[model samples]
Target: MSTVLQLVKRFREVLLDGVWIANTNFKDQLKDVTWKQAVIKAGSLNTIALLTFHIDYYIAGLIRVFEGGDLEIRDRYSFDLPPVESQEQWESLVNKLMSDAERFAVLLEQMPDTKMNEPFVAEKYGTYLRNIDGMIEHWYYHLGQITLIKKLLSSDLI
Candidate 1:
């Protein structure tokens, strides 16, 4: 495979690995927390629900654009946020995020190497290398935040 494909694959791996790590110490192991706990105010950053939503939201948005749909990345959900409120909802979200990631992985794999270096213009970030590298970087960054938040929540629990 080409270098670009390799990089894209590697980034996808990183994201999936990070997701696994985030769930490793999860109080309920992805099933334990109530909606209230998921949305509990951990810090200045958004609650786990918002963060989780953001991850899947972005992935879905980007994939849509890549597939020739027009989407605005900036306009995310607004307000007090929806209550996961139940174990079933939380688990559903987790499954959805993983499914989205898998779809993204497949999209990246199918994308041509030339597309990686092409410019993708976004309303907020402007033009960037519309490629897997940028997406991978974004994924890991948020994954790090998710991991940290999990730790913070754990400490709070104990």
Candidate 2:
């Protein structure tokens, strides 16, 4: 497989399953999470729901770029989650995360290897590979955080 294919494959793996370091991926970690659990603060930290939305927020931006739209996400507002006021809304958010992750990987699969080195939105942001691979890294980072939060929640340690 080409490097581009490898990057996209790695992204899916880290987001969905079989990450080398952490035992859980974003999708698996979120399994069976209730809105009440998701909204739990677990001390002063961000809620699981907030973290989930934050990770997807940037991924959605990259997905937009892949779909020929501009990247319009801002870091300041990344953690701004919609109200998970009901069970259905929580389920909807998780479903959106799954669908969006798949959509992003599919889009990346179609990109030519050469395009990976091209500017992502702008030259200042660096290459497409950097931005896309960065998303995978970002997701993995938050996956660990979510795991810890869940662990704490279950352990009654918080």
Candidate 3:
């Protein structure tokens, strides 16, 4: 398989299926999680819903970039998920995340392997491969937080 395709597969594995190291994915971690559970605050940390939103927000911006659109997402606003008070809102957010993840993988798969070595945005920013891999790393980092927070919230000690 091509490098881009391989990367896309890795992305899918980490997000929706098990990967080599973690043996768990975002979808697995969120299994059976109700909307109520998603909004629960495990201590002072971010809610699961907020972290899900944050993960997708960056991918949304990266999709725009790969589509030849401008990247307008800001770090501060990335975590600014509105209150998911109702089940509908929570479901909507999750659905959006799933859709965005699929789209991102497709976009990456479509990218030529040669283009992976090109600068992503500017010389200082880094190459397409670097940014794409970094995105996966970012997702994994936040995935860890989400998993830990979920466990904390579900435990009796919480």
The candidate that achieves the highest TM-score relative to the unseen native structure: 2
Comparing 1 and 3 on lDDT, the stronger one: 3
Instruction: Put down candidate 1 lDDT per residue, 1-158, tens digits, no spaces.
Output: 88556765565565554334334422233345556667777758777777777777777887888788887566445223467777778878878877787787787777676665556755455433444566666656766666677678879542
Estimated TM-score per prediction? Answer: 0.73, 0.95, 0.94
The Cα error of candidate 2 at residue 129, in Å, is 1.0
| Separate clash counts for every candidate | 2, 0, 0
lDDT of 1 at 63: 80
Residue pair clashes in candidate 3: none
| Per-residue lDDT over 1-158 for candidate 2, one digit per residue giving the tens place of the 0 to 100 score | 98789997788887876667676688888987998999999888889999989988888888887898988999999988878898888888888888898898888899899998899888899998888788778778888888889989899587
Q: Ranking by TM-score, best first?
A: 2, 3, 1
In model 1, which runs have C-alpha deviations exceeding 4 angstroms? 18-36, 75-81, 121-131, 156-158
Could you tell me which 10 consecutive residues in candidate 3 have the lowest summed lDDT?
Answer: 14-23
**lDDT (0 to 1) per candidate:** 0.64, 0.86, 0.87
Q: What's the alpha carbon RMSD for model 2? A: 1.1
Better of 2 and 3 by lDDT: 3
| Error at 76, model 1, angstroms | 4.9
